[model samples]
Target: MSGETPLPATDPRSSPTRRISIVHVRSGVHILPREMLGTSTFGVAMKLLKWLPTQVVDRFLLIMAKMMIGDTEKYGLKRPKVGPLELKNTTGKTPVLDVGALSLIRDERIKIVSEVESLTSDGARFVDGGEMAFHAVVFATGYKSNVPLWLKDAGGVLTAEGKPEEHPFPNGEKGIYFVGFSGKGLLGASVDAIKTALDVSARWTRLSETKDVVGL
Candidate 1:
């Protein structure tokens, strides 16, 4: 690995320290052009400078990147002489959060897999005549949003839990709003906003008529 590369320096095999097992990496890890973030964009700009507070800049940068979410083709870094990186990094951990999903592993050094040999179901298959390994494989899967106890007052209202007894809405079916996760799209905030508004309006309309409605 290149010494100047942003990735934490540690051999995934065994750094004596927890180099492969734990490391602080950027949340969104993808191969990018060395010049991808040139003082022009928030995401790339913050990365360029080491003196700035990431919290103040990460959100804006994230939003900006969201605009180009799947534009990976445009940002594709040509496979080096080493051929394709075959990085499934999106399924791995970032440098900041280097812990396992269910408290599995806790290494503060750097994230890495134990060995490339373990990344397969086909037994020992080192086709490249090279041994690849990692100490930590950050499974960066998404969250499952299920409102376990969300309940509606309109006879049967659906909530976070898909039930009518759990009141997850801040306003309890009236002033409550969930502005995200309505679809598999990226606009989580927008989705939550739209749904919350619809819920509020429907509930109010029901109240105005003094008639109980069944909402499922």
Candidate 2:
């Protein structure tokens, strides 16, 4: 909203032309070391776990977590009882494929707060009586698949929980399609996009052929 004119919702052509800017927000001041964040440890662990049995993968991940984070109790962090791969599979959360950035735990510039209490007329007010002024603030919280209010009458394309009823595409719309809904992470999403593109191209060809046949 700050950088460019908003696209008209009714025009599908404008969807591809729109651009998004991401602003990352963290609530903690204690940043992790650059070495921990940027290391290939997690990536290598994931790759090794891919072909292993689930039980073996779980054990391997638990070992890796101990090696990577070391003594969590000393750092005041509570490690989950379940392994990372198991937790991700059960929760349907995206897998972390890379760790290439410094965490807020080790970053000195960040001032951690308990929680943001409210938005004052000037800026954000923390629950601990701290306040900061800024021109813009963006929340990097996770996503929910809420259907736009304007699309209420479009039939049952989305489920009651707002997830797409169909994988790779939703129902009740001819041209409407979705990519990266597989929850398979970035590389998987790229492959999904390629397959979706091929499918759409074939559908368009069929539609064009039908028009030609009707004319003939």
Candidate 3:
């Protein structure tokens, strides 16, 4: 938690009333509840992306992004050069919830920059040929699955990148079940957990019967 800044009382994330209103509820038509995105309905929609035309999906996402932001010029920002898909593919598919992030950027309370090129004594050089002094540098590198690192026998279960070799949810290989690789986030993970539990239960019951038969 180094270099953590104090949240202002005005920030929505810090406000008790705002927090209560937003939590577990859809605040408006424009804003869908975060929980709904993890539901089965949303999972089906995401799955449909595999079959939908890339151009159509990209256009839809771009329109949605524009609708969410409305006018970028009002916030002292220019339109983004890249579409949502490119950003998602490059940075991964996690949606950033803006509690006070937009306000911070608009007020210049924090700085967003390009990829770092190298580290210097004072600060860091960026890919965009910019450098600035900093009190601290925190790496916001994306998450990586650690399954491949620790799991000894990951032959059929996981790939080199630690992703499930099998497509979609319920990915398993040789009795080894994987959760959270479906890319549907929490809902997919929950589904995997249930499936794994049922499978394991059945196997355990059969094993118990075999032991009883052998009188062991």
Candidate 4:
């Protein structure tokens, strides 16, 4: 989260390239109920409600949204066109509370920067007319599944569309398995990891026994 850069020998004020600037650009959308941020609460709620019909879940979410976030228009936020359950199911993501720009606006420590124009050999130049000399850059990005590409046959563990199959770690392959691959979110993923580990251990034990018997 932090980095150090060597300063130029000359005074920074006298040299144009001696200063460093850090810029962070992002989509301003923020979802809230700040207490729920960075927790698996939303995913657990979704799992518990999964048994209910989609319509029922949707209606429930709509009510909850109203109670949690009132008057979206007043806050310059738009009401979701679809239900939370629908969105979660479609995106394979559990809903998490987000309060977009509100957090940044309230925090005095964060200085928002304008769009980046380009990166020079020494540092980054902002479109608004300033440049910074940075020795390191930290980027926070989301994750993507690369398991399919790693498997001998991608379809062995994934569906035709690249989604994890119901039984993410399927049988019929020797010495090949998966762990921590679940569409059910973190809680489900942990359960899947444990179960898969147990299964794999048992399978290996049986294989070793069979090999000993064959040698006998």
lDDT of 3 by residue, 170-211 (tens): 434576777767664565578779988887788789899999
lDDT of 4 by residue, 93-193 (tens): 44446455334333422334555577668666677898765555555444666656665555455675555666436453555555545545575677767
RMSD of each: 13.1, 11.8, 9.6, 8.6
lDDT of 3: 0.49
Per-residue CA lDDT of candidate 2, range 1-216, in tens? 111111111212223554222222231111111233355544554576678865586676555555664443343233345555555555544333224322322332222233566766755676678665544555545667666454465455667666566643422155566566665556447766787788878878989999999999
Predicted model with the maximum TM-score:
3
RMSD of 3: 9.6
Which candidate should be chosen as best, given lDDT against the real structure? 4
- Structural similarity to truth (TM-score) of each candidate: 0.31, 0.50, 0.53, 0.48
Model 4 alpha-carbon miss at residue 38, Å: 16
* Candidate 1 accuracy as TM-score: 0.31
Cα misplacement distance, residue 104 of candidate 3 (Å): 1.0
What's the ranking of the predictions by TM-score, best on top? Answer: 3, 2, 4, 1
* CA lDDT, candidate 3, residue 2: 9
Q: Model 3, poorest ten-residue lDDT window? A: 20-29
Q: What lDDT would candidate 1 get against the real structure?
A: 0.36
- Runs in model 2 lying further than 4 Å from the true structure: 1-42, 94-141, 150-152, 166-173, 184-188, 205-216
